[model samples]
Target: MPTFADPFQQHQAEQLLQPVLIRVVDNLRKAMEASNWIGTYEEHLLWPEGTTTAEQEQVRQIAAQLEDADPEAAQHLQEQLSHLPMPFPGYELRLSQGEHTQRIDVWNLCYQVCFTHYDPDTPAEVDPHLLDEVGDVDWLALDEKAQQLVQVAFEQLGEGRKD
Candidate 1:
């Protein structure tokens, strides 16, 4: 297995993983875009106490129309909304060393608006911590194929060197 004792090898491993990281991030962005309606629904939930019941009903009507018009999109949106009161999707990366391996995390934040809202001027008011409920990519939880690639990269770093 590759050991990250050497700086040069560590850099090389990071370089090798760059493309994979980019692809994952792109896929995440696409998923977020597809589920954009969740943002609007969440905004409605945050409406002030003075918000009229009729206005709330209008929100429900709009959601119903969206479901009728685009079932697939509506389903996607609903799936996201199910995780409600959570943060939006923003990209972040983290690297850590473990007892037997290195860990890389591709995380998300609510800093960026992941969905479209009814009114751009009025964005959802939410606590920042609530938006950090999900991690887009967690190295430790990756599939076998990805885990192997990462292991191989680390192993290569340990090549021709003693740690």
Candidate 2:
């Protein structure tokens, strides 16, 4: 089994995953702004009466700020968000790794979204030598994991608008 030179490696991985989590939240906020509720029930649950214009505008403003700060990342985040089903308000993505365990938690204000675990001791499919050659973490692998988390979030939330 491969061992990280320092425990901080786990912290580094969490740092890498932060942007992905932020993007996920931004995407959900955008969806809410658009009145693109995941399902009829979700729609009703989130806004039992109806969404106020002020609420919609608030979400829009937050998105605008994020876009203005980094348009490229915003665009990429939008593209990824488009693929996901609608999410509830206040959704959160949490990730952490320990000596032998890696875990992800996706949830919203009201309930749990999805939970995943991985054994860090297990060898990955990618060649170990390649990692050494790069002298950098495999970000693509983390991105894929992030995408999977979003997919699982959507699935756990249930169906949304077809379009």
Candidate 3:
């Protein structure tokens, strides 16, 4: 397992955060689609360094205390808790919106998973260049999990699979 000390600082962080975020988003997407609800998916996540200086200082104090008392345990605790903020300010929400005049709220389930700390106001129009990047997203393709969900739903409905 890669730790923060490795050359993979950002990479490790993304590895953990991205999948978790994606799963949360996917659950929201599935729920919304199932209920025939529509909307953008918004995620409010914590950002490091977006905190106040006083809060950082408080964290540093706690870390120092732990380090002096028990260096080994302190290191482990610090590594695990490093991503967390001392005062824990709050999260910033990001919502997904469609192009043109169409805008949709995230699926109800998505909201459950994402759990916005605060309301997400309308976001600026997405960059057109982002669309080009869309094709590179392999996860967007229908996978076995999605196919299985559809299959089960159809079976439960007493309907045969469609050709």
Candidate 4:
């Protein structure tokens, strides 16, 4: 039998990693789709900053720790939401309470709205000017093209039905 250091063995190991890598990418794409931040591109529905970047970093760390054959196992993780129009300009969705609101940027970046307390329990009578300070928004959620891709990914990721 060939030793672990053998070139042929390494090639076989690389081949074995292909499927796992594909699954990782698919799952990533699906997740990006379901998120509230929308993608900048209409074609592939890709987001590049904020939570997306954070997730990408996490995947990068995972792949770096894995064996050489699967070094890029978690690379290219993203999800596609859908092609629906966002509620606000440059923002897809707004999760808000009273005058406080959390806005998602064009690439899904989250900007915390703070002034009279952005906490959800804040009184509804809080000043509206604070909301203005929160500033204009970008894409709030993922694009529409990503919806189905996200569902498939979630199913494959072991998120089973409630029943």
Candidate 5:
């Protein structure tokens, strides 16, 4: 959301931000793919994002109480789960492709798409090189694109819109 000094810098920032955005989108897509979010069960709450042993146990505990809730429904049943300890505990996706490793929160990204008031500070967290080059980004536009990508992913996975 930063301004650029010139049109060229603006273009460069846009170019540089593309992969970061894709990575962020992929973080969500991959998390969805990493596990089966169906069936209202405790085991369903477990995902690849939480790697630590403590985190795994936390999910196990959260799963036990969700006798009638699903992992996918967490966004909807927040009030139900609020009193219980969090399952994500920090839904940080550790992306290690090639030489660099970065952590992103797919859970937060999903929320941010719906509630835009949250700080879009991820660009800076990934790398200042990206933050320095970024121009004012149309986050709503990017969020829409992310939604499209999620739809495509669901299609590829043969997931249906269940109410």
Candidate 6:
């Protein structure tokens, strides 16, 4: 571990880890995609994240009402829930470089990624070149790729069925 005596030292350390950072995130995503993390939906998911208890209770109440008032709509809601794809889980990152491979815990990798992006309260800006790669990185190109991946998740996932 390199101890930064000052901001300049920190900048150099950041530069040193830039390529590793990019490679980790990229390789992790690639490995996960190859492992079918996105295509397979878990049968256990009912309500996705951000669903409040109150909302769930309200749903239960509505479901009861629907059972008495209109059984058809209740069945439709149940069917929809059953068909819904599971929300993306905190997945493992399997990075393979030739004969070397690293299996990073999802939580720890998230922490590393987040820690890299952390901005201290000091005046040091650090440029925030997130996911730095070898040599100079084309950030604009990355932005486009990011947009496309987001769209794939949104389009393929379909926002959890707005219908």
Candidate with maximal TM-score? 2
Task: For candidate 1, list the clashing residue pairs, or say none.
Answer: 1-155, 2-154, 2-155, 87-131
Candidate 5's residue-wise lDDT over 5-34, tens digit each?
A: 467644655554555446556645554555
lDDT tens digits by residue: candidate 1, 1-163 = 1234357534534443443454444444443344211111111134444556775565565566666767788877676545433322333322223332322223212111121221334532322221223623333323333334434433443422223
* Residue 39, candidate 2: C-alpha displacement in angstroms: 12
Evaluated at residue 62, the lDDT of candidate 1 is: 54
CA lDDT scores, all candidates in order = 0.37, 0.39, 0.39, 0.32, 0.46, 0.44
Colliding residue pairs in candidate 3: 28-110, 39-104, 39-105, 40-104
* Order of candidate numbers by lDDT, starting with the best: 5, 6, 2, 3, 1, 4
Q: Which should have the higher lDDT, number 3 or number 6?
A: 6
**Ranking of models by TM-score:** 2, 5, 3, 6, 1, 4
Query: Over the stretch 72-136, how does candidate 2's per-residue lDDT look in tens digits?
Result: 77776576545433324432333212222212232231111111233335421222221224445
Candidate 3 lDDT over residue span 1-163, tens digit each: 1123344433433333343345544553564455433344334333354677766666667667786767687777677556657442233222222331223232322222222221233222211221224332233332333334433432343322223
Model 6's alpha-carbon lDDT is 0.44
TM-score winner between candidates 2 and 5: 2
The candidate with the higher lDDT, 5 or 6, is 5
Could you tell me which residue pairs clash in candidate 2?
A: 38-160
Q: What is the lDDT of candidate 2?
A: 0.39
- Residue 112 of model 2 has an lDDT of 16
Candidate with top lDDT is: 5
TM-score of candidate 6 relative to the true fold: 0.23
lDDT of 4 by residue, 69-152 (tens): 442442322211122221222333233333444322322211111112223233212223322233321112112222333454
Q: What's model 4's overall lDDT?
A: 0.32
Q: Per-residue lDDT of 2-38 in model 6, one digit per residue for the tens?
A: 2344786466446634543454456445545544343
